[model samples]
Target chain A: MPHAIKMQDKYGKDGFVALLLESQGLDASDIPGFMWKRFPTNKTWLSTSGDAPFQMTGGGLPHAALVGVDGTLLWEGNPNGAPKKIEEMVEAELKKSKSGWGKGAIAKKARGLLYGKNAFVDAAKVVADALANAKDDEKEDLEAVAREIELRREAFKKAPKVLSEDARYLEGVKAAENYAKWVKGNPEWENEANAIVLDFQRPEIVKELDLEKGLKKILASAGDKAPTADLAKSLRTFAKKNDGSRMAARATLLAAAAEFDPNKK
Target chain B: MTLSRLVRGVGMVVVLTTAALAQLKVGELVPDKTFAQMLNSDGRKSMAELKGSPVLIDWWGNH
Candidate 1:
């Protein structure tokens, strides 16, 4: 039986890339650019500016009371009290590590600016500003850029759609299968099999669909009252056997789950 | 030997003293009991819980 791996231990950068390639049919090389664009650096002055006041308060300055010019506090404290200052608070905050902010935050915000709100208008202005003093030959390239921008703008203007919860479970199941294959091909990864299992059986993912109950229902329908461990094993085996179609089916299920109506269905 | 050098040394000492006072030292944890309670009860607890479980905690600001 293929052991489960923890998502945190197994679903790291490399694992995520592998899963995207296997399940979403995305190339690892193509992923980096999309990931990068989706999560552009907060180091940029604009992104960093939004966080400066918060960081100041986090690092120990009473930004609201002390930093605020008005009656309101400038920055609210982390649910906890403010961080302590070792030296100049501003300098210390600027120097702190920038690893806490994840790709999701950047992606969500970038997507909002690019597709949500009036991102297209804002982008058009930026493009216009960039092309204002370009050479005559550069005009064609600028126009092409504008066209591409318009296409993206239209794409963003459309409603926000996310994968369904059921599809996500199937993706998790597919990821588990891929991890099993990778482990089989590369025996060296066997030591990390348990971590890999945990990754596939991520509590958050399971919690999203009430998977424990769903799996039980599926098992009950099949007239099998086996333990959860056995059911999980059976499901993993089924997913592995049905590879490609399973991934698609999983994606569909997830899309449906995302827009699921428990009251109706 | 020079007045400028003497003034620079005094300035360094004052700066260092202020920095030392601002910092939360190992021994100073006793003096700031409320601060320590807040840190342990509210701040550290969440981090510890996240570390113990496979949960993703996002730290963000409204501004």
Candidate 2:
């Protein structure tokens, strides 16, 4: 991690950006504190999980991969073992990249102008300003990103203002998925996409659904008959699987209710 | 622990260890997927917006 930060500092002016990916285990919200305590940097920290775009080839805590401005992998290894390799490769990559209007430089500048705020029109303007003197070859991608900004802006503006519990939950789910697709390759829009999904998964959305499923099954059984061993096992499994949620607690209660009373037995 | 369970646990570990070691190769185009979330000084960022510049992706964690 330190090696990566050092590289970012040394090569950052030459259009080198360091992205630290928090691979699994920790909650998304925990990243800032984690980075601050251990891996502090002005660079951004991204969380990658099951849907990670890149895969690791070996087991280790710190795996590094250097990608060129055109997004091709240029080097891959443990940074600690081959620190010189990264420096050499970045220099080579810098030479190959177009000096003034390289993709990486443009993307980095555009991202700096877009992060943390929600106004798509405002973002589009910022992006437009960054690209105002862009080379002819850079215009296409710049336009595409600007177009995406407008699309996302329109989508959010169109989202319904009021919805019932279930409808709201479903809408949130749909919106998150849609935004996820919209920003599929664009890291600049990841924060908004993350917020959408987090808001949708807020416990309340799944609370009623869990209660309805859990209680309906418990109430359907015949009067005073102890739940069969198989039913007890399944209910226990369900509760365990959903642990920490309200539904899980309800499932546990239902399981207890199904237990055979000693007096009756 | 039963011998069978112990062997199974070791086998699972080996399998996972092997899987974890498989990293990206040089020269391959990196996948352009959006990260779940981003932590940054200015705020969150997306991988998509990171094009045109050389990016060094460090996959690391405390746990």
Candidate No. with top DockQ: 2
In order, what are the TM-scores of chain A for the candidates? 0.23, 0.37
Off by over 4 Å in 2: A40-44, A48-51, A100-265, B1-23, B41-44
- Candidate 1 is graded, for docking, as incorrect
Residue B1, model 1: lDDT of: 62
**Deviation from native of the Cα of residue B33 in model 1, angstroms:** 60
lDDT of 2 by residue, A1-265 (tens): 8887888778776667778776756654444444533433335444534235568667876788888765678887788988987889888767554332325466444433333233344456656786788777677768765765564454442342122222333444555565555454445666667666666555675674545555556545533333555665666787787777655665565465455342321
Q: Candidate 2, after superposition: displacement of residue A186 in Å?
A: 24
Q: Calculate candidate 2's fnat.
A: 0.69
- The candidate scoring highest on TM-score is 2
- Give me the displacement of residue A179 in model 2, in angstroms: 23
Best by lDDT: 2
lDDT minimum window of 10 residues, candidate 2 chain B: B37-46
Q: Please give the range of 10 consecutive residues that has the lowest summed lDDT in model 1 chain B.
A: B33-42
Report the C-alpha lDDT of model 1 over B3-34, residue by residue, as the tens digit: 99999999999986555335222212111111
lDDT string, candidate 1, A27-49, tens digits: 32232222223322211101111
